[model samples]
Target: MKQSGNSKQFAKKDGEACPRGRPREFDTDTVLTSASQVFWNHGYHATSIDDLCKATGLLRGSLYGVFGDKHGIMLAALDHYAEGSVARLAERLNAPVPAEEALRNALLHYARVACALTGERSCFITNTTLEMQPGDEELRTRVAAIQRRMATLLAASVIRGQASGAFNSTLDEKAVGDFLLCVMQGLRVLGRVAHKEDALIGIVDVAMRALV
Candidate 1:
């Protein structure tokens, strides 16, 4: 005879599976994705182990076992975010579309995502730079390296556009790239302040025009 199993065993808790086992092998990718979102929504200082567990649906022991500590998890999450952001930007830069149009669309997309956040306005790297202690040289270096890489990517795109005559060749590549980065960060700040979408769009339009 077939028997019915206990419903409580398969019940969902907080929208996550209430699975039982040796806690299941950790999926690094999924954990990082969830952790990144949590870090994005709540700055490093504000996010706790409990917050991480809730976001990843991992128990406290599982989290510690896989990540070692909060800092380890944060570092992994930051790496994941950085890779995904660069990949998305690269897709736009590599597109066959006109360079000017590609750059503009990329910037606009970034603004939309930034503003979508409920309370935060800036990118996680930017936020971390502002909040992390200066004495934490490792984190500072990591953030700086990531920022430099981003600027380099932007500069390369600008250089390509200039060479193809799609962008203003007269503008300095380094300066233009730096300017764009600042514009993106500024939009994130404005987002935190709950600025209107039109206001951010206006800024993007002006910045894009300057590049072309």
Candidate 2:
């Protein structure tokens, strides 16, 4: 993720016709990655400006100047996370394998990641919705859109599996896709509490049983 710029320098000479002063030397992608982790670990309301400043290694003035506000930085981080997530989903769904198996693998991978021993840094999108839903209309809308994109990918996989006789053709593909999306989000919540590995695996196995 190379940030485009003719210069990587930030500390410029004063009154040199450079109005923005220093011009932000750090990579935008790098800042978002670090900031996203802070927000993911600490809820949206819990994270403070000072927290972001420390996480991104930017002064308060620089962060505010670059991002406008905490909300702006958060919005960018959320978009970045959701984009990466959906792209990964697309890659898994487009794998050179049985559609049904690929779908199962995708679900299992999320489950494993969610249920990992040090699962504090869960999906930022999921964490956002859980933390800010019902009140944060902007973020709620964004998360819903992201979920729809996820559901669309899952439904395509389901449709493919049905066409190949790998899934139950009688079931409505969209319903099944939405169901899987709901289950995966539930798994993320359960991931925070479930201590045993078999418990998470069993939940995933049963969730996949819907594909029959």
lDDT of 1 by residue, 69-187 (tens): 89888887888888887888888777888777788888887678667875573677677777888687878777877877777778888998899998898999998888888887777
Question: All candidates' lDDT scores?
Answer: 0.76, 0.79
Error of 2 at 99 (Å): 0.8
Q: Which numbered prediction scores highest in lDDT against the true structure?
A: 2
- With candidate 2 superimposed using the best TM-score fit, by how many Å does residue 50's alpha carbon deviate from the native? 1.3
Clashing pairs in 1: 121-188
Clashing pairs in 2: 10-22
Q: lDDT tens digits, residues 1-212, model 2?
A: 53332222322321122245334456888889889999998878889989998898766655665677899899889988888899999999889999878988888877888778355666788778877857678777888899999999989999999999988999898998899899888878788777566777788789778787
List the RMSD of every prediction in angstroms. Answer: 7.3, 4.0
Which residue segments of model 2 deviate by more than 4 Å? 1-21, 117-119
